[model samples]
Target: MSVFSARTGLAAALAVAALASGGCTQLRSHQGYVVDTDLVNSVQPGVDNRQSVLATLGKPTLAGQFDQGDWYYLARDSRNLAFRNPRPNAQITLQISFDQKGTVTAIRRGGLDQVASIKPYGKKTPTLGRERGFFQDLFGNIGTVGAAGAGGGAGNGSNTGGGGRDRP
Candidate 1:
């Protein structure tokens, strides 16, 4: 009945017709990735000490405290939807600590191939009061000055670096 409604209905019908004619398959998602399981199982706990594992596997994907001592091995595949380049998606992790004998007491592994969100690590900067003007700023602190032209001496004061002495 209304013009806007009629136009919307026609557009919907057109989209449906296009789909029936087979044009919507191209819109489906296509994700890319790589999985390295052998590399994953190679560094698990009870296998070897932390230094030995680090020598063989190089480095871990993430090494932080989940509990007392736990390492995480992460192999991920990241793809830019609009580009053809493959990013660094493969990662290995090793959590290590030196005991009385300097040995790896524990280890943990996780094969997280995909992550949707990333949180930045570091201190959060708190908001201060309104900024001050140029002269009123904290960094603009002026020191005690007995005199003003150049220095305690003169030639260097004149910029010729005579140290206030005119060469003969």
Candidate 2:
């Protein structure tokens, strides 16, 4: 190849590599609650009531399932590359529990270390029933209907006036 064409090919290869690298460095996104440390620190246990907590930290992401006095504030930042699953970069969970009087009793903070991943046991569950193969299931009842009909009429034996009964 000529000197000019060689330099041009090198430049084109470099440009392609730069574009590929750019796709890998994606922007991270902050999802759910945004934590303000100063504001969160302002909430004091035993001193802050439910209303004060709400005013200071705004609303919580989740409330305690069985108890109305508990609140949970969750936040996470995730980074995703091109065509890849987003991975959690940072996570914060603040759990605030209240007393019967609606005053803050306990406050706890956690990070990604508290996260748990659970996997399913299997794809299909074993059920209780007669197990039949594909062909048995498809044609199993084809010849049984006539035999069932000849055996008995599976209906209540109540007599109707239209069926050879006298009516005044």
lDDT of 1 by residue, 36-88 (tens): 45654565454467677667666655566545443444444444333344454
How many clashing residue pairs, candidate 1? 6
Best by TM-score: 2
The per-residue C-alpha lDDT of model 2 at residue 71 equals: 96
- Model 1, residue 78: C-alpha shift (Å): 2.1
Task: Give residue 66's lDDT in candidate 1 (0 to 100).
Answer: 44
In model 1, pairs of residues that clash are 60-92, 60-93, 61-92, 61-93, 155-164, 156-163
Using lDDT as the measure, the top candidate is 2
lDDT of 1 at 154: 40
Error of 2 at 95 (Å): 1.3
Off by over 4 Å in 2: 1-3, 121-168
lDDT of 1 at 52: 79
Per-residue lDDT of 38 in model 1 = 69
Candidate 2 lDDT over residue span 1-168, tens digit each: 699999999999999999989988887889889999999999898899999999899989999878655899999998888878678899999999998899998999999998676667799767799888899989987767636446543333343546777555
